[model samples]
Target chain A: MIQAVVILFSVLAIGGALALLLTRNVLYSAFFLLLTLLGVAALFVLSSADFLAVAQIMIYVGGVLVLIVFGVMLTHKTDPLNRSNQKPNAVLTNHRAWLWPVLLAGSMFAVLFQMLRQGNFVLLNRAAKYQTTVDTIGRQLMAEYLVPFEIAGVLLLVALVGAAYLAMPERN
Target chain B: METSTILIVAALLFSIGLAVVVVKRHAIVVLMGVELMLNAANLNLVAFSQYDPDRLQGQMMTLFVLVVAAAEAAVALAIVLQVYRHYRTVQLDEVNDLNN
Candidate 1:
């Protein structure tokens, strides 16, 4: 049963990424990214990382996806001469459609596949049991990972302020 | 739910993201590719953490990675918006000039 779920979610994730690659419309790609993020969250739950799964959905879907969609809508191009270009959001580039992307990414996959085929990690052989990791994660973040946790907060604050500043119309 | 199976899924995802980054011309699409790549890495970290009996170090690292990816998306999109404002287009290939 778990195996079936793993396969299903993996397919969903990979298929979503593939759809994002194939689509020309940026807005549609943003929605496809939503699919990918949701699938990854399911995979996290399957892996017994329930806390991370929730965090994934909240941060990626809630925060980042919204920001990306805004980026899409706000950055619509205005092509005056090309009246035929109906979709101003359309990104029409007719170069390197197949060769380099296939070669680079395909080669990297082949390498990782070969490496994993030989991996025999003893601990990883057992099935992961579902355990509530929120308490443990919270404790760790407050205890052992405290410095990094605080730093992450600082980084996020800086990013928020910087993004607002950069996106401000008054700057231009 | 074999570890190798999960790893293979991540590898596939990373590749797809890489392909998207390479082939897509839209700046936002490229950013989507980057997010997919980060998600694949997070999956790897979580999968490895499943077996860690001590501190769940892999998952903790994944948390930090999530933080970084969020920061990256914000900055990148802001830059993309700036690119659109100046170049009047977000088709990356068209913005190849040094100074305009």
Candidate 2:
């Protein structure tokens, strides 16, 4: 049963990513990225990382995706000479240098697959214990991982200020 | 659901992400590709976290990664917007010049 679920989401995630690559419209690609992020979150749940799953959805789907959509909209180009191409969501890209990159990605995948095939994970011999990880994560954030946790907060604050500063309109 | 299967899926996802980043000229879409790659890594971490003694370390690391990724996405989008404002186009290939 769980195997079926895993396979289903795995297909969903990979297929969504492929669609995101194949699509030409920037908005459509952003929506497909939404599909991929959700599928990854489901995989996180299957791996017993419940907290990570929730965090993935909230941060990736909720925050990042919205930001991406806004980016797509704000940066969209409307050709004044071409009347039919002025649609805001029709931000279609025409050309890409696909030959070498696809080749490199495919070769990289082949190498990783070959490497992983030869190895075995002894850790998989044990079944994962599924439990609520929120408390453990909370305690760790306040305890053992406190330093990094504080650093993460500082980093986020800096990013927030920096992004705002960068995106602000020019005073001149 | 073998661990290898999850890892393979991640590999495929990562490869597709690489293709997207390379093949797409749109700046925001490239950002999407980067996000996909990050999620692939997160999946690997979550899969292995299942085996941790207390199951705390892996997720903890993933949590940090999530925070960093969020910061990255925000800053990246901000930069993309600035690039568009300055260059009048978001296609990475078109914005070859540093100054307008």
Best by TM-score: 2
Q: Write the per-residue lDDT of candidate 2 for residues B1-100, one digit (tens) a residue.
A: 4577888999999999999999999888888899899888888887888788463788898999999999999999999888988999988899998668
DockQ of each: 0.73, 0.80
What DockQ does candidate 1 have relative to the true complex? 0.73
lDDT of 1 at A15: 86
**Model 1 stretches astray by more than 4 angstroms:** A78-95, A170-172
Note the chain A TM-score of all models in turn.
0.89, 0.93
How would you encode candidate 1's per-residue C-alpha lDDT over A57-98 as one tens digit per residue? 999999999998888888885466766745544544333569
Model 2 residue A65 CA deviation (Å) reads 0.3
Residue A101: error of model 1 in Å?
1.2
Stretches off by above 4 angstroms in model 2 are A85-89, B53-55
Deviation from native of the Cα of residue B95 in model 1, angstroms: 0.9
lDDT of 2: 0.88
